[model samples]
Target: MASTLTDSLVGRLVDGRYKVDSRIARGGMATVYLATDRRLDRQVALKVMHAHLADGASGADFVSRFRREARAAARLTHPGLVAVFDQGVDGETSYLTMEYVDGTNLRRRLHEDGPFAVGEALQVVGEVLDALAAAHRQNLVHRDIKPENVLLSTDGRVKVADFGLARAVTEVTSTTTGTILGTVAYLGPELISTGACDTRTDVYAVGIMLFEMLTGRQPFVGETPIQVAFQHVNDDVPVPSTVVPWLPAEIDELVCALAARAPEDRPHDAPAALVHLRRVMALLPPDVLGRRADAPPPVVSFAQGTPDDTDAPSSVGEIDKIDEIRVGGDTDEADGPVRGAGATDHLTQALDTRASGSTIAFTLPDRDRLAPATGTAPAVSTSPTAPVDADRPGRDRRRPRRRTLVSVVSILLILGALGGGAFWWFGYGPGSFTSVPTGLAGSTLEDAEARLDAAALLHESVEAFHDTVPAGEVISTDPGDGERIPKDGTVELTVSSGIEHFVVPGGLVGASVGDARASLSSVGFTAVTESGEWNLDHPEGTVLGLSVVEGESLPHNTPVVLAVSKGPEPVVVPQVQSLTLDEATEQLEPWTLAPVVVEEYSETVPEGKVISQAPEQGSAALRGDEVTLKVSLGMPFVEVPDVLFTPVAEARTILEDAGFKVEVNYFMGFLGNEVRSQSEAPGTEVRKGSTITLDL
Candidate 1:
């Protein structure tokens, strides 16, 4: 994905420090870009306000608010809050560098996955409320609280963002007469009615967001901005359980209370709302918190308009309608201020009316105002021909007055009793409770139990495995720390057993013996080193095998045997020289050695006699090493040359050259030494240096 920078600012460096990478997203007030902070070598989100929004219509007012976002965010330091790093302007571009959260916004998440589970919705809203509480403590009001401003990281972290509409509680007004800000759907009644915002306003927005998370949609829907704003002013936020029947009654109450039309009826601030939310969450059962297989269908409502919708209505009739319905009024003032046509004209008129000391009369309907007047009597007419009640008497009037007084007294006594009962049921009954002690986690079980006992709270112990908590220490409390619970209510304390079991790490398979032992010890296993069989496949000191297979879970501190490699096994060469070929081959086979036979003629050794081996007897060698064997053949043989029918001298020379003894046989005296017949016949084979007789 690319950063949401405009084409001109895409590759441009802002303030000569942040290198713009790509555009991330664009909003009405600013375009956020993914950028690299060259000076710090970290990724940051650079929010550059729109040129016109920064220095145009609203001018300094808008810029001042833009700057306030940076200041407000910078002052806050919470994990749930995005960090502001730097703020500056390059030419006409006003930008702020902030922590870049690598995750999708809640709006996107809701769009992709629909509504969240009961627990998940509460957790997300709780985290946002926590952030808001922090801002409220600092006297800052996050006027604009919507799903788009809530970010959910891939690592399961939730952060609240976009303080663009944030303003100090001390500020006289959020904007000038012509300007009205905030999303219409999340706007509180006071904000839409009188343009007055405070911490309660943020609480209202969070409540609306919580409803959307649980039910998958906002409560109010209308065709136009005025209609929705009118609903915010007049209608009560519907209970989530109405749409999601399975939703807990507690959640419905929390949402409705936070989003109350009257500010005073709502929680005093975000912290107060958060406390109520935590209490509601703590009281919920596991089944309610768990994911539902049959999730509720998405609630399709009217699409919300842009941020400028706060100024949508431009007529006195619309204002009167909103006001009359809001305050239960009926009379219409003919001299109401006439509004102009513009984006903020309606807002200006509303604020101007208040500024001009002309208050818009808010009169409740007759029925809703008070009980009907009583104790009145019919008067007798004193005109000619006028009818008079002759039966009417002073006694009758006195009797009627007495009866009215008695009825009033009776009604007051009944109302008092009912109000007291209601107060006891809601305030001092089982619902009334105090939060658990803080820092209960990580305390010794005995100490935690003692504290709970002192608080007159009953508790049960439960064992669970924790990665960081030590054995016998409290991992967590069921109601969790700082959650309100009924007096003497049972709380479950989960104590850590110190990693009861773990699977053998697969990484130890080919690791060194030392590394394997270390890994085993790290996982609460005792490693016993043992010498393994000699193997050529693995290097010495390397892990050959384990007694237990990888991924097999075992009890803590179990003794595990580690087999270390000793390399290839050595073999001693046996005596094979001076032995027969068959015997030598058999002798080498026992030692796992291969023997190569070479035959050669020898002067003393008999044919097929014992041979000599290359690797002498008793030589150390590895298994499968080759050994050479030299076998004895007889003396070299050559063919005798034929000297028949030749002269004696020539024959003798030839016989002598052939290295054969010449023997002439004189048959018939004086015959030339012509070898007519030879002891070795032609083409006959004989041993070299063997005596051969020549007959003549």
Candidate 2:
């Protein structure tokens, strides 16, 4: 091991940039050091690979994979993920610089202060999930997800570290118990058996971590680490409440769903699990969310180790000496830790052995989806551990198939030797009909068909959209279970094809709301909502557009918002007829109605007063619609003719012809016909019917 004082890179600069400070921690593959970036002026955790890994037989491949995976990890930008800054070969030492976390790793925390309350456990797991969701979106999987890789900062933030580096190290890692067992403790069963994995593999590890958080231990334990790994393949994770009686059923359900024995049974990815967890969180009462469980005694973690400098791979051969396993809590009682001194005593990390470098590739088949105790694990071997052929599933598969074949053969032989009378009765007589089976609704299509075939009944399949039923499951049948049907009668089987989606039909953008609604209904989008806005280009109730694009697909009953036109907004024409023309114009303008003035004579109204309006006052009109205001000019006026010196009859005739009433007055008993005086002044404007006095 390289001592800090004797460390070649300690207190020295690497790659003309990072200044290595003190060593923080050491892992199986690399040594983590606190370092300062001269250019960025920030502290970073520098993970420098050992010399032998850079100079070993497969050195080039190791370097290539290391740089590639590092680059991939750098693409992940999320608050909950430890940010990868840079990766390069500093001469003989290959290194990676990452964001420096200021707090303890989850493994350390769990050892010291975990077995968190359900709420706290849920919160921490939720944060980890949020971080994984970012990687899932980028199509990158974090092959390793144990507590050791989860960094909890002092500021109450959770982050995931070491993305994609596991696969880089797997090809060259030793396969011995020491190299595999410690790291394999949390792996899903499928990864162990088939060496295939996807995002779900990570989900399984998180589920185990969550279980540990809730109960202070992983779900399985054994005499040897291999026994513990086999427990995952053979047994199901027991309910959490089985250990903590106070835990609600929902918590058990959540843990089981994430860590289901079958990979298909678990959530598809971190986001899905996150969604389910939040739902459970929402349903729990405030007290439960706020409650804190009693704390266990802090287990001591590994002391900071001296950096390894020897040519050998660090910690690989220590697994051959394994014997008995002792744990913090009773190993039998539902697989959870009970509170006690050395609550995690023998297994501070359950043998957190630091190796030169090896990791399980997590090459788990999706058919899925992990440790031990010890003294401080001693020096690890660098020799590559050959892969073990522990094909547990294949070894177990034959028993079930043989049992099924024997059962089928036994049933056939007994039926074939039936007496002729009995055979006739069943095939062509009274016993020809069979009763349908019950409890088939949730069965897989294949399973349901097998049951139906046993009944000797003919059946036809039909696919339909179902909101709650999973795909390829029996939804319903024409003749329900337990109903008697003829042997040859065809039963209509409605199978769920999973949640159905419909493409938003074309041409809905310009159609009427009614037409659009009908079109959507025909295609299974029945949950349509109409949102209206005043529009000049479209008629009232015209469909303007949809919430999604025209051809986009959406699930059953997903809300489809119809952006419909409400025509132009209706403008209420105020009682402008009785108002003055100026007042009418001012009131009508704000209603978005355009006003037109029409001047006309009125018998009683004063001039400039609005007499009447088109479409009547207070009637509805579209915005921008024209509203004509008939303004009044009062009574018609006529100029009084000059009647001062005219003859009395002539002046009277002139006044009458000009629409003025005339009255003849006698001057001094008898007046001259030619001379007259008018009541109204000559050429003066007056109401047409006003009386005019004429003197004769």
Candidate 3:
């Protein structure tokens, strides 16, 4: 597995979140890749199922099951467990995401350095049990437990990996089918005999792992995995002290107690076993806890690195196929394990299938061939060596490649079609967008809507006034006409309700001229002309009316003329000359004129008549002006004094000067100017023209 351009999925984005960077390891079921989580911006271990499993007839069911299992693993949150973050299927690629531990796993540590001292082994086992305890509390079982699954982080934390992935493969592995699922080395007896699983099954695997840690070797061994699996059912894991003579008896008892053949014989679960192991740790002497029980194994390094770093199988022949022993196969290692199965490698393994009183083997990629110590060791790691292409676990090197001319041509054609469809669907099809219809600014609403509908665009109509556009015609579009819009997106259509017009309100007559003008202006009549007109009916300063008729609808700013009242017309003097006082008073009533009478004498006119008026006839006068009239009185009387003895001419002169004519009368019809005797008594009051007679 070299880093190259042809390394499938090495540069691919899985489910749009994880970007596969490099191949880490591969197993019977899937391949583990070191990838970056594009969304979270962190490194992760991406385990993608092999193409065979994902593209098989039961691929859908397998992926569905895998998603469910991954979800279950993701729910378990503990510091000691490698956190499962997400799981999804992108096309045929079904994958799971887990936290990347920088340091190697326990198997690598044991390979680099031999068996751990009592304290170190207890520490590793303690962390494993802690993680298992949490899972078991939630009724979850780790079907595969081995050094490969126990990861040691560079920051000094021990974590258990692969929580609920095994169960997902129980019925999907092509080789194993419905049989066993985990490695053979750590399969519980119950898993081999009867497919019944519980927390106790994991406890059994942990015990076996404990035994291997103390003695630097597994409790059982054989030429084939069948022999090793049968040993767990028929034989008891010997006390670790048998191999490591200096190992404590309590540690031996801890191993034997957890690895019991019967489910009930083992501590009920990882919790009980954890409690028991802790008790043993408390009882063990400090000196014993600090020193290794066995000599260190020679350090071995390879250019291809350990099974954890490469696609190679474990050097100790840790790969185990459960269905081979169950279904009776000569070759082909099954990736699934019996419910509680631990094999040589880690990271990738079979699903857990429960069998009773029987141990099943599942091979996993062992990523933990790290350097271990009892009390203290370097808790850091250098970069892994590059992988080599070779006969590796879980992969069939004999699988033929299909690259015929016809197949290549067919694939090219299919890709071309797919590309074209994608382009149209996201570019010009319903998935993309379109422009609003052009020339819709003044188009009818019905026409604009029809065009929008043809363009596959929705529309909304709004009414507004337009100066140029006609009524019911489109004024403008929200994105403007011809602007881009989504194919199914709504366009705001502004329809013209016609030019804005207002009506001058009625009832403005008799109102204040200013108020009337304001009322007219309120309805858009800004231009106004005002004038004062005398109105008898309306009061002064009130509106006589307007030049423009009220209640007439006109365009905005139409001019209006307001008629303001100055009052009634000025009164004219009446011609009451020679009229009586009553007649004059009656004739002046219309003018509201007051008649002021002054008695005046008229020589030839009768008395008590209006001789003349002060404001003469037909003259303009105030409404309350008075007209002075003079009434006629009788003429003055003259007295005749010794006119008979005076000269005749002198008598005539005297009479004429008195405003009277003197008539002379003889004894018989004499005509003389002299007055001998007056016609009437001279002492009487007579008119000035009284006749006077004189004797000659």
Candidate 4:
């Protein structure tokens, strides 16, 4: 399990786009956070490398390598592969935004549910191998292929993630830093011994993972990582059936062949491994396929014996001594023998000394000891002076010779029996079986029956509804296509009853409401119109969204709620004429209407008063509508002008020219030729266009 540093990055936004919501998980290299991609309005997983690893002198190199790996992973576009959206560096925080997976990884599943059934294990590994096949085809090798990297989504979708250790297949070494990469338990022999890696290395890791998934524990375990890694280089992976005796023999063979000590012994690539696995799966019976019980309890190696005399090596002291041979950078070399004469001599001496005591150790110096740890021939030295007393009597010497011969003959006989049993089980049993008919899916029932008859296999039809297959055509087979079945065995055929269910198509998010509804109806669904809300961003009649996401499968005639856009909501304009500017602005605030005040001189309205408004009042408008208000600034000031001695008509002309209304005050027909007095004093500042009375 990985631990997260208590860094306060939780509410911090990375690169100004990914707003970190909370921490998802922390691994040895990076910490993942659930974040929102503000630009795209979608959730993404933000993987931020530790600051210490991203900001030191060697940080640039690590960050650059991280970026390259991220780019490489982003190029792979398969449903089984987790999608990488974006990558960048923010200050000292180097991060990658990826598609957030909504399920636990295989490690969690294994811990909670124990080992998986043969069929389920094969399915999970098959999906992982399929994903690896895609990567291998692109010349990419996922260096780390462990259970922690395999995700089991909630919808029963298996996806492979964490391509952080992935590199191009052409790369000779795991890293330029000269440090061995990958978990020790899953590291391949070639990678551990020579520092050389390729597609087969990944295959070897998958094999180890398969073994663990089947046995509920890793194949190799030690007190230290170096001890486990040495096991990978020096020891062959044990057959799974040794631990889980109920497992099929074919499965054991497949796992052993995959986890072989030599690279040449494993599959060429993921595709080749997948082929072998599928064949193994096809040969399994229902007892093995459907066995859903927990794995048998782990066998303890050290109960009441010395460490070296146990069924398996129980002490790290002996294994750690093996690492001494490759110390001082010798492990980095790709050529020459890694084990020196001193190491072998030391191991031989230890075994001889231990055998001299009351305890009986199982250590052997022969290279044949590298055989699998299962029921293979046990290690027995043929040397005459191995652990015998030559000073005894001549009869004693003869008796020792006779005992050694009996032991050797007995071991040979056991080996022969084990070999013959394996041959019979695979050669004459399930391994020689015929595969079920191919192209049976979507084939007419009559055609499928003919094919099955030609193959000498029995058939039973099981009717089911298939969305894509036509009526009376075979949708699937019980044993599945390409599955191996014994001669004349029964294969269940499921024929389609036409498209009785509807599957929604993708890319319906931005489509128009009418087109989306019509598309749903065309696919045998009832498009129910749901009440729509006003969306300012989306255009009218455009689909705001749907009740369910696209690509969902539903029963026939199921009602799909369609949410259309009604555009922006309409607002009612409030009456604000003849009111003060402040009052008018207050009145329009509730309607979200903006008030624009334009000041002008007016004789009928007072200052700061709204004389009239655009679009009048009580008019319908959209929210955020702008309403222009014509406000009054009172009458303009003007001089009365010197017209005391002028005639009334002359004065009137002068007053009118100065933008003022003039009125004559004639008492009893007295026609005054000159204006004696004016209502407003001369040189006085009065309102422009104001009425002025003149005395005659």
| Model 1 TM-score relative to the real fold | 0.47
Cα miss at 90, model 2 (Å)? Answer: 2.0
lDDT winner between candidates 2 and 4: 4
User: Rank by lDDT, descending?
Assistant: 4, 1, 2, 3
User: What tens-digit string does per-residue lDDT give for candidate 4 at 407-445?
Assistant: 999999999999998888766765557789899987899
Q: What is the C-alpha lDDT of each candidate?
A: 0.69, 0.68, 0.67, 0.71
lDDT of 2 by residue, 1-696 (tens): 233665667898999999997666555456777789997678987878666656768878657756775787776656777767799877788888887877766766666675787788899999999888767655666766777667778799888877744332234232222222224556676655444466777788899888778877567754344455557766898887776667788989899988876776676668667767888898999787776555534332121111232222221111111111221123425644433323333232343332212222221111122222335668887988674457755566567679999999998877776766687888798677777888877888888888888877777776654667888988776567777787877665767777768798899988988678768755656467789989977888899888977788888467889999988987777777788988988988788777888898887788899888897877878888988888898789889889778878778888899888877778887856665567788878998778988767
Q: Where does model 1 exceed 4 Å of error?
A: 3-6, 54-57, 172-179, 293-300, 303-336, 339-696
Question: What pairs collide in candidate 4?
Answer: none
The alpha-carbon lDDT assigned to residue 17 of candidate 1 equals 94
lDDT of 1 by residue, 1-696 (tens): 533233677788898899988766654566677789997678888888888865557688768878887887776655677767789888888888887888767766676687888898889898888777667766888776777678888798888887766667877354434133566667787876666678889899888988888877788975444456667877899998887887878988899888988886576667567667887888999888875424455433333322222121111001101121122223336744322232134433343343221112122221121112244589888768654466766435466579889999999999999999888976788766767877788999999999999888899876655446799998677566787788868876767777557678887767887578657644545324466877767877789788888889986445678888876679999987777888888888877788877899876776676557878888889876889888888666767888778777787788778657677778787765566777888667676667877778
What lDDT is reached at residue 518 by model 3?
50
- The backbone clash count of each candidate, in order, is 7, 21, 49, 0
Best-matching candidate per lDDT: 4
State the weakest 10-residue window (summed lDDT) of model 1.
313-322
TM-score of each: 0.47, 0.45, 0.44, 0.52
TM-score of 4: 0.52
